[model samples]
Target: MWVLVFFDLPTETAKERKIYALFRKNILKDGFNMFQFSIYMRHCASRENAEVHIKRVKKILPEKGHVGIMCITDKQFGMMEIFHGHKTVSANAPIQQLEMF
Candidate 1:
């Protein structure tokens, strides 16, 4: 099981600080690896372990902010695909990716 965890605050001001603090306190406890900014993807030995982590995250998260967790199976960890204005671009083609002009 792959879990994608995201954290969002109500405002930009102080959001990074608060989120980072929460991340340090909660997510780091179980030694899970982060997948992206404000997102953590981890493989657990069992569902109980995942649930415990999620509960801990919920406990530490800010009351006013939004936190989301999604579980997906068999998804590549670093699969890259470019999208232009909601359109998917082939990875093999010479189309300019979003990172370049």
Candidate 2:
């Protein structure tokens, strides 16, 4: 499972800008990786774990621009197509197994 967060918060005033920074920091602190500007992704061990992170995001949500939270199966997340210009990068592949030392 994956918890994907997409947000656009107001930054018109100093206070609003502070809020925006705090929100971004909160998400990062909560273990989300930067997927793109204003977008983040966190891989969870299970659906229940994803729900926990989702609730944390909601707690720090701003009362301004739109903030979206979504959960997708690992298969769906693996289908993402990332490209830069004509070059393309494959989505993250799941580990087949972990070798013991």
Candidate 3:
């Protein structure tokens, strides 16, 4: 499965900007990759693992913004088509994990 987080927070005020940066840093520290501006993605082995990140996000969410999270299976994620202007960008990167025995 894959977890995708999308957020758009207020950045006009200094405090709001700080919160925005904190949210980004927190997710990055939590292993989410920047899929796009305000969008982050991570791969998980199961729905339970995805819920872990979701709960973390809930903890760090700010008060004045919209945050959306969704989880999709590997097959569903693979079927996603990405494009930039007139070109296509591949979205089939294999999920890499470090499993400790």
Candidate No. with top TM-score: 3
Better of 1 and 2 by lDDT: 2
lDDT of 2 by residue, 3-98 (tens): 999998889999999999999999999999899999999988789888999999999888888999989988998888899888998987643534
Best by lDDT: 3
Model 3, position 42: C-alpha lDDT score: 91
User: What are the runs in model 3 whose C-alpha is more than 4 Å off?
Assistant: 98-101
Total clashing pairs for each candidate: 0, 0, 0
Over all chains combined, what TM-score does candidate 1 have?
0.57
Inter-residue clash pairs, candidate 3: none
Clashing pairs in 2: none
RMSD of each: 10.7, 3.0, 1.5
TM-score of each: 0.57, 0.89, 0.91
Q: Which model, 2 or 3, shows the larger TM-score?
A: 3
